[model samples]
Target: MTPIARTRARAVETLSLDATATRNALSSALVSGLADALTDCGKDPEVRAVVLTHTGTTFCAGADLRDPPAPEALVDLLRQIIELPKPVIARVTGHVRAGGLGLLAACDLAAASREATFAFTEVRIGVAPAVISLCVVPRTDPRALARYYLTGERLDPAEAVRLGLLTTTAEDVDEALSPILDGLRRSSPQALAETKRLLTAKVLETFDRDAADLTALSARLFSSAQAREGMTAFLERRDAAWVV
Candidate 1:
């Protein structure tokens, strides 16, 4: 119930994911608050950029398995970030998995430390990355995405950059991002909005066209008995029946 995120000064809004209780899992509050914060950023004339970061060691552990997030909630949040007139940057400093990858993909830019890890882990949980695919598919490398999207294997930040998931990977995240933020700060708000619209036009189209079907698929998969077993096993720290 703690605040999911907040915005700070410097024409920069830092949305901190404060759900350390669940390893910063994407809960209802986190998802809805993200959407609301992004909307606020777009409306605030003083806010030119937003930074998405988390307090926990884990950047985002994906859905709150005990009370999984609705596909619609995630879908809307991703859309809001993509369509936001202002720039959104992801300051990744820890592990990211499942739906978290989607949030990373929605960002206009991302900076991560060299040690962070990432994974597309839905397949292991008897589900698919249906809702998240809208953003993830555009940024992720095809061949690598093909493998990781299916295998649920983990990748290092360097590999993630090679796969186009991260914009910059450095030993120090702030060192990597300071220049990018400065350059963004120099641009006018109107130019940023227009340029972002130009850049995200196709992504927006795909989301409008496919979000419904994708969300439906995600919902169906999560509701299945097999997925229930997988989630239960995951929470209990055991392998699901399907795991060989």
Candidate 2:
């Protein structure tokens, strides 16, 4: 099945994470599909902006344990979203976890439904949110991230907004995004692209500086004994040995 479904409304192109059976997990195939879609949008004259959304109760349940992408691939996908010439907006109306947060952080703007939830669950699985921190750390409030990243605590939409993980939260997410999309449509393509570069320059710099180290750390940790135990326990619907 196609993991990404593309649709358009005038100048706004929407790319949906359509792998509902996996809760849109970032398997290698889904990552490649999304990257290719974003690449096409970046070069398309009619696409002034892109909306990245999902089709299940979970926006993304993080990496697909059974078929995880290479850490480097995840890093490149996040960087691609940040560097895409057309603005990418995350429209989340469901739960997001672990590496999924990286996707949200990479977007130029994000809006979520009040029912949406978020968490950095890597710690619970004996790995750290390493690769994602490249975008997540710089964009979110450091103090809030410190708490959530360490504890793997769940955050509601309002708290996510307070932590700078979301642009806004509304009972109807699409209504909230309508005006933003309208404004994007009215703006000049060159002006929007230049302004996005200005906004994302700091983020791109962090990626350039820390991506290699973070990807290495992620690869090392995911292959660790602790992660093996945690993943096994999780698959078995039990707690890891370290859990008290």
TM-score to native of every candidate shown = 0.97, 0.99
Predicted structure 1: lDDT: 0.89
Candidate 2 lDDT, 1-244, residue by residue in tens: 7799999989899999999998999999999999999999998998999999999898999999999999999999999999999899999999999999999999999999999999999999899999999999999999988999999999999999999999999999999999999999999999999999999999999999999999999999999999999889888999999999
Candidate 1 Cα outliers beyond 4 Å, as residue runs? none
For candidate 1, the per-residue lDDT at 23 reads 83
RMSD of each: 1.0, 0.6
Q: Among all windows of ten consecutive residues in candidate 1, which has the lowest summed lDDT? A: 1-10
Q: Candidate 2: where is the Cα deviation over 4 Å?
A: none
> Could you tell me the lDDT of residue 229 within candidate 1?
91
Give the Cα lDDT of each candidate: 0.89, 0.95
